[model samples]
Target chain A: MLLQQIINGLTLGATYALIALGYTMVYGIIQLINFAHGDIYMIGAFIGVAAVALFHQNFFLTLATAMLACVVLGVTIERVAYRPLRRAPRLNLLITTIGVSIFLETFMTVLKGPQPTGFPTVLENVTLRVGTLEFSSIQLVILLVSVALMVGLQFIVKYTKIGKAMRAASEDYDTASLMGININRVISFTFAIGSALAAAGGVLVGIYFNSVSPYMGVTAGLKAFVAAVLGGIGNIPGAMLGGLLLGLAEVFGVAAGFSTYKDAIAFTLLIVILLVRPTGLLGRPIQRKV
Target chain B: MEQWLSSVIDPYYQQVLMLVGIYIIAALGLNLITGLCGQLTFGHAAFLSIGAYTAAILTRDFHLPFILSLVLGGLMAALFGILLGIPVLRLTGDYLGIATLGFGEIVRVAFTNMKITGGAIGLAAIPRASNLINVTFFVILAVAAVVLLENSRFGRALKAIREDEIAAEAMGINAMWYKIQAFGIGCFLAGISGGFYAHLLQYLNPNDFGFLKSFEILNFVVLGGLGSIPGTIVGTTVLTLAPEFLRFVQEYRMMIYGLLLVLMMIFRPHGLLGGVNFRRLLRRRKQKATALSS
Candidate 1:
């Protein structure tokens, strides 16, 4: 029973990590929370549902389409809403992102009519037993896809030229620009990749839960954001670790019959972690220059 | 004249005014914290909820009078503000915002699950002791206090902190105490506003005081002009009244609000007033006209 719950927790955590990667990446580069990132995840889920229901696409096609759609949307948002305010106060940028998030949520709500739709079963649910542990095919698929994506992300960040530019830009944007790197392209690429990951996570979540809604992103986004903060807001690997830890904590909290307070657990844990280690686990301590 | 005015004004208009008055109080409080103190709080509605519930329970169960319950409710919220501020206030900027957001959610969840708060069903049939006149009186009082405080020595200390916290600390200003006091005062007003809100609506739902509502109050502060009292009042009045006039676009109201927020931040980060004194605008325009004529 414990093993089954752990597996379930890991599956849930994988999706959160995917979403958290987007948050951490954006914060890493720009220091903006990208409040609308979660909404992008929601839109991804809706797009997936539409691709399956309307176009009769298969699971892989739906995932790809959703990811593509979100990439375009994410880039557009960065270009139009956030890019102009790049030189503005951090608070202004933050508030603008909240506005962007609100717009995305309301726009989606208007289009989708605010009803939770069950994801059409594109893949059959088949349970597998391996040495006293029972798991479903969907769980395995989610795990494999998430891990593959994370690995791909790791490779790109570690080896790719664009990834190098991203690291340079994040380290010192002014210096990066002075060094003749196109800051705009780097930022846009970051949004594209981060948004794609979130989209994939959204589709996986929709499939795993078999339900999707406009507001689903709010809670998931917040939880994943907490995970990001837990591991360290701007650290990619920290976001992944935080997501998994948060997921396990929540599952254990539920298993202990504190289901009603499940949402509170993530927040409470975040508060405790913040109070204890303001930089978060795995996060480097910030040094004040002056 | 009084008879004619009373006859001319309808209950609907009164209700709208009452709501505007309530929001004005809440927004004014937020202005002190977010505007003057330079702290961005995303969970102010939590304080409002505390006050509303306290007042409702006091009146319903303890048989307290409306005024007494309202004051006590505000005090209760102020207490929570101090408590929440003690730990979280030390964190700066976005971290503070997240902590407050967490605090807000925790308060909401506690309210939702607790039996006395009536769970998610919410507490209904709250006494309808709140009205336009009393709400107006409180609004006037709050405005007076804020304006007076803003110009006073304490207010200057707050502005000094807002300008440069490190510098303010170097100047021997107790930054932590000021922050907590500002937070407490801001929450006190939110609580009082919530008291009026509950009695006026005669319903108290934990859902009403979520992050969205907090965002709405922040909108009023930002849209008006940070640290500007008149701006907050005007912002709240215009926003509250805008929905009524734009009833045609009620469904798209939030979307429009979102767009406006983005646009406002981009074009006028200082807000509509641009932190320019309104009185100076007319004079500047006149001076420009005079120069053009010359």
Candidate 2:
């Protein structure tokens, strides 16, 4: 029973990690929280469903199509909504993101009514057993795909030349720009990558949960943000760890019959982690200038 | 003035005007924290809820007088504000915002589970104690209080802290104490506003005071101009009245807000600044032209 719960947690955790990555990366590069990122994930889910249900596409193709569409959307949001406020106060940028978030949610609501639509089941659900723990093929696929995307992200962020530029810009935006790094391109690239990952997570979650709605982004986005903060706001590895731990804790809390307070669990952990550690588990402690 | 306001305006607009007054109080409080003190919090609604519950319970169960109960409710919220501020005020910027958000969510969950608070079904039948007269009185009183507070020594200290905390500390200011006080004052206003909300609506539900409500208040402050009193009032009035003026406005309210935020931030980040204050601008421009000519 414990093993089954752990597996379930891991599957859930993987999707959270995908969305969390977008938050951490954006925060890392430009000190903005990218509040609209969650809605991007919601849009991705909608697209994934459209590809499968409307166009009758296969699973992998649907995922890719959703991801590609989101890449364009994310980059456009950055270029239009965020870039102009680049030199403005951090507060202005944050407000702009909130506006974008409200815009995207309401826009989607206008497009597709407020109700949640059933996700198309493109992949057949087959029971897969590993030892005594029984899980579905969909769970296995979600886990495998999430890990693969994360690994690919790590490779792109670490090994690529643009990744180098990304790191420099994250360290200091003005300094990186002064060094002829073309920080605009780097920031846009970062948004593109982050949005793609969130998009992938959205599709996987849609497939797992079998439903997608305009408002789904609000809760999942908040939890994923909590996971990002749990691991430390700007730390990539920390986001992954935080996502898994939050998922496990929530699953176990639900298992323990605190189902009514399920939403509270992530927030409680967030508050405790923020108050106690402030820096997160894998993050470097901030050096306060005396 | 109260009689004239009631007799002249239609019932629908009277309710709208009353809601606008309630929000003005809350937004002013939030403006102090976010705009003036530079401490951004997205959980101001949590304080509002605390006051609402306190007022509802006091008036309903204890059968206390409404005015006295309202003041007590405000005090109760201020107490929680200080408590929440002790640990949370240490963090700055976005981290502080998130922590406050967490606090808000915790408060909401607690309220939803408590029996005395009516669990999730909500508490109905508080005395219909609020009307235009009391709400207007409170609005004028709150505005005067904020203006006085801002022009005082404490207000300067808060401004200094907002500009640069370390510098404020270096100048013989007890930064932590002032921050806590500012946070307390902000919550007190939120509490008073919550009291008004409870009495005006005559019902209290935990879900009504969610993060979205907090965001709406924050938007009001930002859309007006952070730290500007007249600006915030103008911003709130404009936003609150937008839905009433246009057809199908309720449906597209959030959509327009989103668009307005983006366009405003990009083109005019300073918000209205109370729309240029034409007289003051004309005087300034005249002064500039004369000086140049001379």
Candidate 3:
């Protein structure tokens, strides 16, 4: 029973970790929370829904198209909402993101109506049984895909030239610019990659839950954001760890009899963690420079 | 013309005016926290709920006097604000925003789960205590109070903190104390507004004070210049009345509202009347720019 719950927690955690990567990457690069990232996740789910409805059982093609759509949407949001506020105070950027989030949510509501739609089941009958342990093939696939993506991302960051550029930019945008890295392109690319990951997470979630709604992103995005903060806002690996821990805590909390207290438990944990270590578990402590 | 005005404008228009007055007061209160104190509070609605419920319960169950209930509600909200601020105000920016956001959700959830608060069914038939006279009077009173607060030494300290907290602290300002004061005052005003809303609407529900309402008030402060008194009033009025005026576009109402916000942020990043104070602008204009010496 414990093993089953752990597996359940791991699967849920993997999804959160994927989503948190998007948030952490953006925050790491720009120091902005990108409040609209959750809405972007929502949009990704909608795009996935459309792709599934169109492609009908062609899982790979549907996933590709949804990711592509997310990339475009993410880049556009950056250009339209964030780009203009490049030099503005952080508060303006925050408000703009909030406005953008509200706009997306309201627009989605108007377009799709306020109802949870049935996600098309492409892996409905695929169950794996391994000697007293039962698992859905879809869950296994989601776990593998998420881990693979994270590993691929790690490699890209460590090995590729663009990855090096991103690292330099994140370390110090001005210094990176002095070294001839196109800051604009690097930032845009960062948003694109983060958004693509969120899109992928959205697709996996839609499949796993067998349902998607306009507001699904709100809570999930919030939880993922909490995970990122718990892991340290700007730390990529920390975000992953945070996501997995939050997912496990939530799953176990629900599984252990207090289903309704899951949210409270998660938030309480966040507050306690923050109180104890404001910089987060993997984050560097930032001291006030006199 | 006079007869036509009285016949068409007297009934619902008066009610709209009353609501606008109440919301303007509420938005002004929020402006104190987000604008002046630089606290990104996504939980103003929680305070509003506290006020509304306090008044509703007091007036209904305990048979308290209406004015007493209103004052008690405001006090209760202020108490809660102080409590929430102590542990949480140590955090800044997005951290503060998220914690307050969580606090708001917790308040809503608690309200929903509590039996005396009527659970999810909502408290109904709240006595209507808000009329045009009382709303308008309180609007003036609230506006005057905020203006006075803003111009006072405390207000300047709050502004200093907003501009740069470290600098403010370096200058010997008690950062935590001022923050608690700002939060308490903001919640007090929000409670007052909530009391009025409950009495005006004759109903109170946990769902009614959700994050969306908090965001709506935040929108007012953001769209209006932060820290500008007139801006808050103008932001509240324009935002509240725009949907009513654009009622013809019912299907596309929210879309247009969203578009307007985006456009506003893009074009006037400081807000519609940001930076320059209304009084200061008029005084400067009256001085005639030194007649353009060139």
Give, for candidate 1 chain A, the lowest lDDT window spanning 10 residues: A281-290
| Ranking of predictions according to TM-score | 1, 2, 3
Tens-digit lDDT track for model 2 on B1-294? 757876888867888888899999999999889888999899999999999899989999999998888888889999999999999899877889999998898899899999999989999998878788898999999888888888789889999998889989999999999999999999999998999899889999999988878988988888888888878888888878765674477678779878988898788787778333334666999999999999
Model 1 lDDT per residue over A1-290, tens place: 99989998998888999999999999989899888899999999988988887567588898999999999999999999999999987777888988998898888888877888898887889999999999999999999999999999999988999999998988888999999999999999999998999999999999999989888888899889999999999888999999999988999899999999988999999888888788789887776432
- Indicate the residue-level lDDT of B25 in model 1: 96
Return the TM-score for each candidate structure.
Answer: 0.95, 0.94, 0.93
Per-residue lDDT over B1-294 for candidate 1, one digit per residue giving the tens place of the 0 to 100 score: 434645888878988999999999999899999898888899999999999999999998888999999999999999999998999898877778888888888899899999999999999989888887789999999999998888788888899988888899989999999999999999999999999999999999999888878988888888787778888998898878877876789678778878978998899877765474434666899999999999
Off by over 4 Å in 2: A55-57, B1-5, B247-250, B274-294
Can you give the DockQ of every candidate in the order shown?
Answer: 0.66, 0.65, 0.46
Model 3 C-alpha lDDT per residue in residues B99-167, reported as the tens digit of each score: 887788778878887899997899997877677777788899998888888888999999999988999
Q: CA lDDT of A151 in candidate 2?
A: 91
Worst-scoring 10-residue span by lDDT in model 3 chain A: A260-269
Give the Å shift of residue B140 in candidate 1.
1.2
Fraction of native contacts (fnat) of each candidate: 0.58, 0.69, 0.29
* lDDT ranking, best first: 1, 2, 3
Worst 10 residues of 2 chain A by lDDT: A281-290
